[model samples]
Target: MSVDKRKTIFDKLLGSDIKAELLIFFHRNPSFSGSLNDLASKINKPIEEVEKAVEDFVKLGLLNEVKHYYFDPEADKELQNLVLEDLTKEESKSTFELIKDVEKTNIEVLDKLLPDGFPPSGLILILSDPAAGKDILSIQILCTKIAVGRKGLFITLDKFPDEIRDFMLEFGFNSSVFEKENKLVFIDCYSPQVGIKSKEKYSEDPLNFPNLSILISRVLKELNSPIVVFDSLSTLLQKGGVRSSLEFLRSLTGKIKESKALCFVTLNRRAFHPAILAASEEIVDGVIEMKVEETEGKVENYIRVFKMMRRRHSSSWLPYIIDVEKGLLPKT
Candidate 1:
């Protein structure tokens, strides 16, 4: 019959090249009616191979074969345009260059109590209680960068992008800004535990970084963004163990120093091992430690900028609150 034109066409078009290229060939030589031999000689493919391919294309209704074969320009119009599309190739490098270039700028967003430009390209840590606002504050830091047209990567070990989005909205950010602009990207670490996609994603390419470090490294190298956030280091060490995870983090901090990106890392104070914490302390540019003290029924929390190496941080903890409208409000 009519070859069920739609089904056969889509199936064969899986390996099809641009229709525009075929059209150009026809334009070059208006004498287009050809057996596979004539078309292959013109197009520089082996006639035998072209014969089989043409047969498949004809079955798909993308070609017509009467005395000779001719392409049906309408059969796979949209797919043909995509096959002919050269856009993805040309703009890839510049996008990557822009992402890598963000590290050299001098502008920094620091605490109000501390000086304005804190830890410009340095590594920083957010240490806090399990349920504290460190993760929320980190998201605010990212949204702030995104508002300025800068980009950030969230390599989350504990939260999903949707949950992070919900958390952002809870902190007063409209999630659409992230969805529309794509200034924020998520690398789902999901867990240090061996469930679901973690182990496979971590080990998929054996040639890459060992365990979590490799995952983080490939991301930093590939991303040209100005900021990166590792949601929680404690989880990795707890799950992947001291030597593998900690060594990877140590190497990661070193690798990150070569770029201009601001690396904001998160760590859990209670569960974090001494070696991991020590590695972070020695390598990162600053540490923002969050702790809670209980007075009767109320529990109070504070953030101390314990150390900011290159940038001068004040003597004590910088106060910050999670404001409904403003997200993370730095106390003066």
Candidate 2:
């Protein structure tokens, strides 16, 4: 007789089939709480069998029992938000309406990138090498959106809110004024790593993916037609494995697309695994590849609109210069 080995590890760890099923049930229904009898009836098992499973879970600290009811003690608001409806579609504007709105925004930088402006709603993946000015480019884009009277939410895992503000100020963009006017918000994901408490609108432990999602969802829900910028996915990938990081991005992007908001996520090409980069490219609406080239020790930075779904854009790499007064300038 052939023995099944697939569940061997799980069975040994859970000790019984009923316990494994109970664990699986709680995992699938994280927000559920029920009395022992109710759980047994739901699982279609006898009361005694369910009781044994519940005892095993409680002893292993996987579940908590109080007054004959069992629940996952570790399940919190963050976990609940993580599993929230990611595909809830919002009524997006028509392509024509979106173009009109973009024109009304009057962002010059975007005018240079796409004479027509960004797509109505979609994700843009910004790829670049380290210190190649990816963050600066993202900030410039966000500042332009804000300048055009659009609200923005910047979730920065690479730099603290203060540092970002300082950089923007140096680039001649007054982001602090926007913060004071409530036109812009920053979710500081870097402060916790340095043991610094954040005074920004939203702050979260960068390594806690669930909390990060919850914070993002809260901001997206409150804002209207907001431009969201995630200041580097490579940092997230390092903190969370490729699977969890990609899953988080997929869920977050789904929410962004449904809300019809523009989102830009920076990814360090050298930092990400090739497979991860390829998978991410498939999920976004466009890919902006930034590169720095050195010819005879003179360096030049260029950007290419490698892909933009449902739109016509320049496929050739365009040279760009960083001017202290102008931010990112596309050289003609």
Candidate 3:
């Protein structure tokens, strides 16, 4: 917009990416390695571009060379700057910058366009058809959090501990990662023993979310990560009707709003009513729809941020897919 900006390539570049597109993408996927091949396949970017881009990235100290693999690039710098160096007031500008950035964002996730960070702290809904890889999506998000040593709270209305463990093992996530990292945690809201409601009023406390709120709140207070997800809203509302579902979700959203976590709720379109969906619309920050359809004469999977109550929405569905060994990869 300015003559001076047009004259300078760096100046034009500074504000050109006025928004945080690349940062948000990596934030959504922190655990992923960014090897030349991996980054090319995962981002649908050209291999040569990835190599050139990452070479500049490493030279800038924005990324680290790890076992010949490139980190999220914005890898945690805070922990790395642990050694304290005495400083005086009004030192060199570089020294000032280094001292101030003691809490380095070593996360390979956030070092995108900005040297700062983009924190995802809001509500999200992931809706898909039954058996359409909803659980896999949840696992991907969970693994992303764990990769950065951040904790995850999975409030499941569907799967049990053993069931989830088995699922992750299929994707090469070892049980030690869960236990040692203490990253992945599950709140079994699906159990009737915790107030799921049976003939005798579901385990003594009838209106309780079957310990759903309790576990979620605890995780919120403890987790250092920005990501949190609910397995499936369908099961939470399974015993209740549409009105009850509306009330429960409304209350749940209110509770989630009080926390400092970015949240997501999974749903099946057929399992929910259109009227209830409309009623619960106010509490949602955004709705992301996942679908598999024939595109370019092939079956493709996509994740699109359809609506964002707080910000402008992405008009297109970003396509993504998973391979047998590589796991979830963003297609477009």
TM-score, every prediction: 0.58, 0.67, 0.55
Q: After superposition, how far is residue 323 of candidate 1 from its true place, in Å?
A: 3.1
Locate the minimum summed-lDDT window of 10 residues in model 1. 89-98
User: lDDT by residue for model 3 over 217-243, one digit each (tens)?
Assistant: 666676654467776776544454444
| Clash pairs for candidate 2 | none
Please report, as a residue range, the 10-residue window in candidate 2 with the lowest summed lDDT. 85-94
Query: Where does candidate 3 have its weakest 10-residue lDDT segment?
Result: 82-91
Off by over 4 Å in 1: 1-110, 172-182, 191-194, 197-215, 273-276, 318-320, 330-332
User: For candidate 2, lDDT tens digit of each residue in 1-332?
Assistant: 01243123223324554554564466557667789888998778999988876775566455667775655536433322322212111101113333444342243434556655677678899988776678877888888788878899899888888888888888778887888888898999888878988887689986788888887887887787689899878877766655567778888888898777899999988664232455577568778888888999898888877666655456577788777666767776
Q: Say which candidate scores most in lDDT.
A: 2
Better of 1 and 3 by TM-score: 1
Ranking by TM-score: 2, 1, 3
Q: Candidate 1: which pairs clash? A: 99-224, 100-224, 103-260, 209-214, 304-317
Q: What is the TM-score (0 to 1) of candidate 3?
A: 0.55
Model 3 misses residue 327 by how many Å?
3.3
The global C-alpha lDDT for each of the candidates, from Candidate 1 onward, is 0.58, 0.70, 0.52
